[model samples]
Target chain A: MTPSAEDAAAGLQYSRVLDAPPELVFDCFTQPGHLTHFWAPKGASAPTTEILVDLRPGGRFETLIVNDATGATYATRSVFLEVHAPDILAWHEEHTGMTVRVTFTALPGGRTLFSLHQSDIPDQVLRPENRAGFATTLDKLSNYLHHLADGAKQ
Target chain B: MESMLKNRPPGSLDAAFAALADPTRRAILTILADGDATVSDLAAPFAMSLPAVSKHLKVLEASGLISRTRNAQFRPCHLERAALDGVGDWIEDHRRVWDERLDKLDQHLAELQGGKEERDDS
Candidate 1:
């Protein structure tokens, strides 16, 4: 599924083309076996025991990541908002009030372009005025912070 | 396993989100990010009246995004670094998590497909 203009403005977006088929890439996200192999960040591990995926709308998709060095765990609980195999997977994270949408598109040479977009839904859904300038504001803030850091270094 | 990371207080985050919703308030933040500015200084760029600018400042101030100095007559608003950092950090942290996970997924896919090809040959 494509992100709307408002969603694009207020959301965090990331996309990367992987050297695999869309079906395989989608399975890596939905299947516990594939997810257990790479669900957590580097240095953190998501055990199959803790990785749960009920791949239907309104179903649960949860994971627990344990930091290898710190032994710290981060758990996420989300409900699937949309689940269309090999194409789209969207979920609403309960704790953060953020909805994450992931799309996988087939490329020319057996590759898949995986894109993820996350946005805070509650405020954006309630108020329309807040949507347009969010991403631009963030870009300005990020640049400003970088400038401050650069000045400090010099 | 114990959950190590605690979620940020939803109230403050909610306020920040709400405060950032308006284009005017966001423009105010952009102005303050470069340097602190008074209501008059902020309002000049937008052609907005002082009261309207003050209203946006109030929302920003309440959200802890900007603080106004009490000593000066104009009460210049200073951007609160912590609040801005909080919002940036939240997004960055999630982005980092997905980035790393996707990197691993790339490697896993190669291995999975390699094993399948080997099996087909055998």
Candidate 2:
């Protein structure tokens, strides 16, 4: 599926079809027990040490991941923006000023098509007055980089 | 994700973030993105004085976001492509982490269903 204009401006989008029902996949995001099982990257663990999931609009959703190789800890403190059970979940990450939206579409065979869209890369860095200019400049910068890369190949 | 980004040399990404925080500095980078510009050319867009613009340029240079040529008469400011790439790297890092996490989720779901199947068989 095509990403929204804002997401296409400066965002990341990912989709995966999982072998689980929509409710089960949704539960994996809202429930702390299920979230802790797979909320971390490889070589890191989301230790069930301090996970708080308040499943409602404006509620808190936090997770702490510890790097196994370096013994470092990364904490995510975000506020839920939308929480529709068995369907859509979205949150605003406090540290990065990014909004993450996840949707679960139930498939025919009881599977779930999970989609994630993350945006607002320039939110924290740019002021409201500068957003349009910043976005346009980012687009220019991307084009310039592409031009440079193309030049380097010759 | 924080740890992964921090694994890079400290202060590089932090400095880029800080450099991009200023509106004027960001505008300056935008100008440089189009083509290299002299200090006078950069200062012409804003009402700020040359020295004021120079101060901002100093910060940008320190952050490695932009560089100035060693030309004595006219040191044109050039956007450091690598530093901007570093900012893009942050997003790339997040994408990679999410990719890995989803893989873990896939495995977790399999294990969970496998257990359910075993329970149903018994």
Please list the C-alpha lDDT of all candidates, in the order they appear.
0.70, 0.70
**How would you encode candidate 2's per-residue C-alpha lDDT over B1-122 as one tens digit per residue?**
22222222222444454455455777788789789999999999998899999988987887677888996588999987656765655545666888898888887888878854422310
Model 2 lDDT per residue over A99-118, tens place: 78888999987789897756
DockQ of 1: 0.16
Candidate 1 chain A lDDT trough over 10 residues, lowest sum: A1-10
lDDT of 1 by residue, B25-78 (tens): 777888887899888899999998999888888878876788989899889999
Which residue pairs overlap in candidate 1's backbone? A130-B21
* Residue A149 displacement in candidate 2 (angstroms): 18
Candidate 1 lDDT over residue span A1-154, tens digit each: 1112222333455677788889989988998888988988899899899988999999999999899999999998999989998999998898667778889999987888887756553333223243334343557465544432322221
Off by over 4 Å in 1: A1-4, A69-74, A95-97, A121-154, B1-30, B38-64, B67-77, B115-122
* Stretches > 4 Å off in candidate 2: A1-10, A122-154, B1-87, B115-122
Which CAPRI tier for candidate 2?
incorrect
DockQ of all models, two decimals each: 0.16, 0.12
